[model samples]
Target: MKAFPQQPTYTGFNEPSRVEADVCDLEVEGELPLDLNGTYYRVGPDPQYAPRLGSDIYFNGDGMVSMFRFKNGRVDLKSRYVRTDKFKLEQEAGHALFGAYRNPWSDDPAVQGKNRGTANTNIVFHNGQLLALKEDSPPVAMDPDTLETIGNWDFNGKLSSQTFTAHPKIDPQTGEMVCFGYSATGVDTPDIAYYVVGPTGEIVHEVWIKSPYNCMIHDFGVTRDFVIFPIVPVVSSAERAKAGRPTFGWDGTKDIYLGVMPRRGTARDVRWFRAPNQFASHVMNAFNEGSKVHIDMPRAESNMFPFFPDISGKPFDRERAAARVTRWTLDFNSKGDTFEARQMTSLVGDFPRIDDRYAMESYRHGYLCVSDLTKPYDALRGGSITGMFINCLGHIDLATGKHEEYFVGPTSTLQEPVFIPKSATAAEGEGYLAVLANRHEELRSDLLILDAQRLADGPIATVHLPVRLRQGLHGNWVPATAA
Candidate 1:
């Protein structure tokens, strides 16, 4: 029984120590309009959801929605409702916790604040219940239609301090849900691994990820009998802080390995596969093909660690480069195992799927957009075309390896694309794509829509938001038809 950290000392999730000055007011505007007709809805941070430290409170501040809006030629926001639940902030037994540490962005050494509460993953729907993964808390399940919390599973009791990234994968057949969590002592670590919450929300399955290397299971999904995950065998800041580990580069190489662990088998029975090129990156989504699997990613040239230091206003010396789309596939036959992959698309960035219309079933086919945003503050630091690019909303034909860039963007910082499917549309077969763009210089967020198929032509309508949204992590599209 590993002990867990108290609530007040945690910093990740929706709870930032303090709100940045720029996101305070929702008055910022973008280069484009905030409305699209075919898309049903676009929901993200506004006055309701932005991080709060003072007397302010969030309105529609919680929950997640579809990353893309529609299948139509002209995109617009499709109206749909989303719900999120606040995390539990209790200090577990026998753990040391503190509040008010030095602010990441402030120069004041005495500055302090409450530990940030967990910002849950874009909630997922399974067996008539909506489930979400929170950073510092447990897995919670809610109603997709009503957004009412229906269940929760605590990981704090299982490990000392744990955090979750990306959405948990759901087993479509068994009705069981799966998610990965990392636990450490303080901010740094000698961490343990655990899997929390089955799809039904009653079981807290403790997962043991075996590796000679340090295992950090980030984003993953589940198939009939195996839990597919991309593991980064590396140490974290907490581990470094405790072990006195110094920062260095490719000086020590970390391999990004894919492991297929049996759902009911022990860790020793897990079969592992390693991707050839080690890119400092995150696994967006994996397309499962029975024995074979395909992975989609935003080709990162360098380690993702360097990008973290500059998050607190520090300068990160990085090549302002764009990531390409690459696919890795593995086929496990009765005789043996085989691996094959290729560069799917170039000039593209972060991808999210709206529906099953794309060539590959994973994020690669969802919404493939292009941007020059290699680093977080690259645009804020006066780089020309920093906040620029075009967003193409449509399905990529994996067979042809060609992306029909429909909704090409001249927009700023487009976000994960969500599909609203034609079922949510009044025009029969016409569907929409909903996207978020930070057009204004001061972190103003806007909702943009496009015809899912006719995206290259441009958006039909757009909705400019009067609030700000968090810039990292992933979200999803929850259909209005869902209850």
Candidate 2:
């Protein structure tokens, strides 16, 4: 038996539930839509063994992939480990061979030169295959139906980069997956590889570019005309990794840059627009109106992850870290270096999602998990390991500038909400939201199905789970016809 650390990351609702199960006919509270068919796949960090260093961040755990299959109004769940190289090595040794998160220098000597991907960030289905992603390594392909690990996929031997982004945008019109890999050459390098994968998983186009600085480019934006990469101040360096420090840290001195390049252009055509120091991640949606491009995302004034401390030695400021939905507009006609930014909502939240059908086009209807600090919270039940209590689901109507939220009770928190269109041709925002709610007191989770148009009305159906899933980063829903 292994004993995990008693820290908050390993106790209470955050405690590791290393369970692989196949459950059928889950109890439902309300009527599930007959059209609600397909699978909701989510991947999160669930460490298989206690950390070799006796302590670890929640992001450093092993990859656990969970799939909820819906068929004929019945739901079934199947979960299994991703079986990455790191997972297999540690499983064979019966102990952890990896070290700190993204710090290869700290890994044990025996596991040197091996892939360190956790595949724990997000799971996306592309070209008939499920890709388990960690951003630092190539995608781990899995069977879409069985959820069985296939292997590390390299686009049938075309992807030369060592890394691939966990967040890949699928164009509804062209059916192409637009993705890029930062630090493409190595762990802390500035090289980024941009790829456009066709509908059949073939590499349509690949371009190599250099970032203005080495930073954590977790997510990016893509419109019909251009791809936007926000280079924030979460800086990383080779020296820091060699010194065994955290792979990334907040550098307030660096200015934020949004690199915009034509969808079919080369690296030389890339334009770097500058902005003041701030933190932004997880794009909501991006579209263009002729020469001007708009990107909506959650923006904060400072670092959000406390584990990645400030490089300047400044203590993390919780107030400044509250992220709000903000829209940034960049004009190609203007010669200026700065873009216009406007806060779209007052809700403090991250993990934004929009209807997939209208992606890369002028559209509305966005969903996210909101952390309403004004509401009552049960601290005794404990909050997330990130030290935030996300207790609400927010619906953002960009066209009307209206924000509506549904608060889950004081004893529970919510994960990222994914939008499920009612039908293939449903109007924009005419869909349902699949959100996972963590019941802290019960030590389990419930999947809430809410009408996206009337979010405040609460869940129309709640799918209960017997086991508690660790806080997950992101997930997506695949329609039955597509799956």
Residue 242's lDDT in candidate 2: 79
**Residue 255, model 2: Cα distance from true site in angstroms:** 0.4
Worst 10 residues of 1 by lDDT: 94-103
Q: How much is 354 displaced in model 2, in angstroms?
A: 0.6
Q: How accurate is candidate 1 locally (lDDT)?
A: 0.44
Please, what is the whole-model Cα lDDT of each candidate in the order they appear? 0.44, 0.90
Q: What does each candidate score in C-alpha RMSD?
A: 9.4, 1.2
lDDT of 1 by residue, 1-483 (tens): 222222221211223222322211222233322222222322332222222222222211333332333222322222222222232221221211212111122211232233332333455555555455544444555444344455553533453344554456654335465666544322333343546455545555665554434433445645454565665533344333334222112312555666666556566666777655345244445656676766665555543444223213334334533556667667644344335567766555555453533322333334555553332433443223322243344455555666666533333456666665555333322466666665534445566656776777666556555434443335555454433
Model 2: per-residue Cα lDDT over 1-483, one tens digit each: 579989988898888999998899999999889889899999999999999878878899989999999878889989999999999999999999999888888889999989999999999988889999999999999998888899999998999899999999999898899999999999889999999999999998999999999999999999999999999989987688778778899999989999999898899889999999999988999999988999998999999988889998999999999999999999966789899999999999999999989899988888888988788987676454355668999988888889899999988888888899999999999989998898887888999999999989999999999877888888889998887
Could you tell me every candidate's TM-score relative to the true structure? 0.63, 0.98
